[model samples]
Target chain A: MKKVFAREEYCLGCKLCEVYCVTSHSRSKDVVKAHKSEEITPAVIIESGENLSFALQCRHCDDAPCVRACITGAMQKDPETGIVKYDENKCVGCWTCIMTCPYGAVKRDEYNRNIISKCDLCSETGEPACAANCPNNALVYKEQEEEGE
Target chain B: MSLSLKNPEFLIERNYDRCINCQVCERQCANDSHYYDEEMDKMLSKDENCVNCQRCVTLCPANALSIRQYPLEYRKNSNWTGEMINNIYKQAESGGVLLTGMGNPTPKKIYWDHILLNASQVTNPSIDPLREPMELKTFLGRKPGKLEFDENGNPFPLPPQLELDTPIMFSAMSFGSISINACRSLARAATASGIMYNTGEGGLHQDLYQYKENTIVQVASGRFGVHQEYLEAGAAIEIKIGQGAKPGIGGHLPGEKVGDEVSRTRMIPLGTDALSPAPHHDIYSIEDLRQLIYALKEATDYTKPVSVKISAVHNVAAIATGIATAGADIISIDGYRGGTGAAPTLIRDNVGIPIELALAAVDERLRREGLRDQVSLVIGGTIRNSADIVKAIALGADTVYIASAALIAMGCHMCQKCYTGKCNWGIATQQPDLVKRLNPEIGEERLKNLIRGWSLEIKEMLGGMGINAIESLRGNRLMLRGIDLNERELAVLGIKHAGE
Candidate 1:
């Protein structure tokens, strides 16, 4: 499975990743106004608590429960990359996938559109934008076999 | 306005009643602004020679003294504000970006203006740049000792020349820190100007490949975005030993700024920390530097020239000698006041020596060692105008590189906040929208215009000096005379004070 790993030690807390992620998903790509608008919500949020602050995003799983729990067929695994992708067109405004996923990867837009949004692995670009722009080399995109085998 | 005697020693005044004598002011002044004249039994001021860094005023324990213009003024011209007149002239000629190098070129008492250039009136005929063909072109690379010819009478082998159409070239700046747009603009400008733009320590972007002939890629300590292909993709390779700003410190591109494109170019994973080590791990001694230089030479099949760039430190003469001996084709010396995309404000303002002193010392050392012509010299940091360029050449530089000046031509305001990456001028920011605002076409044209303007002025100055060629001015120290300089300063510069 392709996973995003963070070397939390190297994170400088610049928050550029969060801005990029939000812009990539938002309709306008305007960072300052995106947070307040109900139509768009950032797919990834940086969790800040006590000495640690890190970006939280979907970890595309091998056997994903979000895909199985989607009653409206909104979530599905790509056969090629095993990446769980959320389709807004078929999402049917249900929160089943959001409540059922073990990793809480599913999130809704600010407008209560009921359409789920999650990390799509940036498969189109071959590398995650969030991980690409991190200055500290704190993030890496690698397959399990390549990383371990 | 009343005119006081412009003696260098009597330029300052100190109020002892207001003076706490805490010595904080003395400690902060890099130019020794405040000193106790033991024989005179009073504190003294060295105001006339001060560069006006203002460190002493800000750090003074008691608000005892203030340094201001010595209250001398010329008749004011109300018809045009200085900035307005300059902007009008800049816009009229190029319809391009108003590119300039060094600090603000506003109306200041530039030392060059006070020193006049002599012309040949009775002895030699003055050549006009417009009518007579003048060669403003400069080649910055090692010259071969002798030509080698094959059996067929064809020259067998010789080093390639960094054929710059003009003497001006873009100085080094990295890719990861500066936006790709800025790099692209520099590449396009360099190509158009028939000059070269250095890649700084940052690796080259794939998109810049089209302008490879005009690119001078740099290999800095961080080795970020460097690979074999990256090494071969430039007209010349520069090994960045030091930068004028923050000379001894390494660069840190905060992870936040390491976008995917930067990470990809740098060969590091995206979003990871990109740390440029302080010094090259592979290079230790001069011999080690040679190994790296030869290694690059081998990598590129000796097709490209290798330049070594270093900051002008106190021992720059010795360092430059070592670099020349290390088989570098060119030696670029950056002075202390050089500009940078991002460096600690403290380091940028405090470190390194001035180019004037460094250049003279290096030239003297190289000439003494019988290796003056072994390497080409390119000096930068703060080369403000054509006059400074001529002065630099006389001090032994073959050519000069400019960065901050170029950026200003491309609309950089010099807000001194390049590290934020939210540069309003789009020269230093990575934000896509801001980057696009620079418009590379205008940037390129502006740079071309700036160089063209400077080249004409340089030719005029050289012609006025009774020297028709730029090369004739190089290392001709007899042409310079230091004004208002002490004996030691004059000795170091290898020139006599005016009226000596």
Candidate 2:
């Protein structure tokens, strides 16, 4: 299992991770007015609660319920990286993942298009944009085998 | 009145009969004006996108191409005048400031043409570069007072150094101002050339880490993306005190241009204006400058040399002396006529002194004070050809940094509209669509070719002066003579007018 761990103590409140996440998902790289329009909604959220602030993103679980809850075969785990990914074409305006997830990782586009979006571990590049661009080095990706030993 | 001609298409015409196809036109054409069409089985011309640089026509092997105004007319402005009507239309299109790139291509007096080079006739014999081994290797960092060696016959206590296989170096241009591909091109070229390229105030990107040994990271006043790791990753750290394009004024990467990549690198929020403050808040005096200098040194563990770059201005001599004493390992002075991706027209047109005078004055002042050895000098701002490099070293500089020249090699038309963020050449655009146009592989090869060409010419120029090594020409004023210069100008340059 591959997971992302955040060091909240090192986070500088710069919100670059959220920006990179939003851009990585956006059709265009224009981040200035990315969230202003109704077409795209930010996949990652920067949440602050009682002196603790960190980015909230999808965690691609071992027994993922989002894949099971999807009535349409829109959500599935990739065989290569075991990453939970969403297929917008098969998404039939379902909110099952939004309600079933315990961590509230699923988010809808601003137009209320029932198709949900979340981080896919940036598996295509093997390095997440959020983790790569973090200036403070707060975010890290660790494999389960390496962590266990 | 007749209806204005709409959908007017402009195209270029080339005389292939006179075209030798020597690749000079192909090399200089930034827009791919002339290309050999494989399928068509002939050379094709696309002069419509030409920026009227005249480089292709000027350097053409057979003088085959000449850029002319399109015959298509919007209206018969026989009485109104084409230029006047064009100016009105320009004012209407963008009320915002007009920006451009490259050096001034206007028909101004180029000083190199007026100046003449000396030759060996009676007393000295001229060395042929074809026969003799000419050394053009230039070291940019501070040199030691004396070379140290150990008892075991090995070099010990090595002085701080940066070696350049050639004297040419890629000048400062932030990653945000240009594309990732453009920076990649420079990085690859610098690595291949055994020279250095500067990251102008932009934080180092992860992709450019492979070229870290050949990179010189710059720290300007804003300290936008500066961090501990960025500081330590460079061979040298350049403190940008001022830019020749817009002296005393700071730079502002507009919110629109601040994409996610630039925003992340700068450690600022996306879409917010990245303001580079004109002056460092902590540096109000020379003492404060010293403190920051030592602070950086301490942070880097004294491994990398620190260079302080300043625009040439009146009293630059005094400023240079102060910067040297402030513990800087190198001093880079930019003349007023330097090129910039985006600068206020008012600032670019006016401000500071020419490099020739500024370099001479600073060298004289430093030598008089016996502090010339304290720091190495690197001059820039309109160093066009290898002759300028030779003249600059003979005047006083140890090496020179070039940006516009390098860009020209990488297919920049010098259209001078870099501020608009729609650069056609992909050298000065932040937009992803435009940035993708430039291929780094081709761009790097072009930069390598330019440096190689300039290096050969510089070596030839040195050989013409009967100098075997570049060191022999450094501060050797006897080889240079000024023409059409008054006594005061001659005295300032510490050289005599022609026929003295």
Candidate 3:
């Protein structure tokens, strides 16, 4: 399973992951235009503590609570890739996924308050933009064997 | 003529391209928004039945479903808002009062954001928490009135204290309000973090007895399952006179939620209404409160400190003085924006004073009365981040209690739907299927991470202030300045303008 892991100790709290995420998900896929003109909301958020900061995103667990708690079945994990995905079309905007995501990874898409948005591992690029753009490698995307399998 | 009601809130759409005639949405929807059409071999939906919970969306295998808010707009009238009209219609239909949960969501001035912290620039050297020891350790209890030495030059005997490695504590979330898994997560996290978690009104579960050293069992008006053994199974005891969410009111756990497990935990009859009284009938006066405090001390043999929790009201300073004089070792003040399992919407949004003003007033009053040293102040309402904690300490709180933040860490979305007992996140539900959604292991890890993150941030803030210990920050309003506050607010907060 491919998952994103946060190494909080190494994080600089720069929030580059958030910036890259917005650009990657932008319609034009241009960083400057996405930031300057577009109203973009990044899927990843960076939280800073006393002397430390780190980026947090969806962990895409094998058994995700968001999927279970979602009353309308808007949140689902891919059977093949183990990627936790959001179907905006199926979303009813109840915010159950937002409540169920422990990491606070799922967010209300500002453009459409009715649909919850989250990290999709940047499926188009085959790798997460946040992990790729991380200056300190604080966020890493890696594939691992299933625990029981 | 009867007014025409608004249209259904949500619009459910199903794509036939990928759908293989599955009926999972029909089975998963608690609101019964979906149903299978046997004759057509297809799925149909009723928009009015859906509350947009998104359960079926997550369970769908074909990934061909979508739901959106109905794009129906009434004639725009700023004076008559949609919510106002909808609420009026709802009340007209049901003839019942609105009930809500969690903290207040209405936009209001958050004092923590207006206040700015001062940092050491040149003269005072900033201490690096990484290199030097930054003491977040705190002791919650009555402090000695004076420093006295024995004949052998030993310090005087100290009162009972709840020692913590950090000043942050996980606030109250009763077992009945939240699931056992949620409580277990908090218990394990408290033990691991060397802090404390309160068993708010709800009696402690027997399985959590092992974490008694880090637990704060409460004795609310309901006295749900408070017994001799329950009193002794905690580091301290909190007498909950009121909660911040719904001040001057009681909590009601519907009979439907009073299942066998909740019944056993609360020591109440199954299917009985577990209503906590608004006031402790015995505590009519300060003297009466004192009597209860002493009674609890005697029950625990003076081994545990006694805390009195009250909502922040207009006369909070005077109320705090009475509580302190009544011999409460710790006085916990909950602000207006505190969370609750359930509360009347009217009371939750429009009652009680803010914690910031209340904490400042109480601290100033206690100090002026020369009784500040006798008790520890633990404040809560909406303590959101580490900066807020630092701000609280500067405002004179010994430590801060956190409930909503901790719940968020455990997967609460602040949807204010807890009163419905349909909390999909599992933290505030009694339903077996829903409650199982919260895994204790994951909950604990998330809580630990949140606290650890906050601790690091707190230490860094301390370092910026050139302070090495949290004690130095307590009651030090000089370290804080109000940026946008007026003269009255600044005076009330006891802080100067940011530029001043």
Candidate with best DockQ: 3
Superposed Cα deviation of residue B457, candidate 1 (Å): 0.7
**Interface RMSD of every candidate?**
19.1, 21.9, 17.2
Off by over 4 Å in 2: A1-149, B1-110, B147-156
Q: Specify the CAPRI tier of model 2.
A: incorrect
lDDT of 2 by residue, B1-500 (tens): 24332221335567766543334455345466677766865567775556665655654434467776667565676677664465455556666654545444434444444455676876888889989999988776666667777898777765467788987788899988888889999999999998999999878888998899999999998897899989988999999998888778788888888898988888889999888888888888888889988889899998888999999889899999999889898999988888877776656776677788889999999899878887889999889898999888888889999998888887776667677676656678786545654667778998998889888988888888889899898888777888876778778777767776
Candidate 1 lDDT by residue in tens digits, B313-360: 989999999999999999999988788766754466556777788888
In CAPRI terms, where does candidate 3 land?
incorrect
lDDT of model number 3: 0.86
lDDT ranking of the models: 3, 2, 1
Q: Give the higher-TM-score candidate: 1 or 2.
A: 2
What TM-score, computed on C-alpha atoms, does each candidate reach?
A: 0.61, 0.66, 0.74
TM-score of A-chain in each prediction? Answer: 0.81, 0.84, 0.89
lDDT of 1 at B426: 55
Model 3 lDDT tens row, B1-500: 27557568789888776554446567455466888889987788999876666656654545668888787877899888776688788777778988889997767888999999999998999989999999999999999977899999998779999899888999998998998989999999999999999999989888999999999999999999999999999999999999999999988999988998889989999999999988999989999999999999999999889999999999999999999999999999999999999998888889998899999999999999999998999999999999999999999999999999999888776757788888766678887656655768778999999999999999999999999999999999999999888899999899999888
- C-alpha RMSD values across all candidates: 18.4, 14.6, 13.5
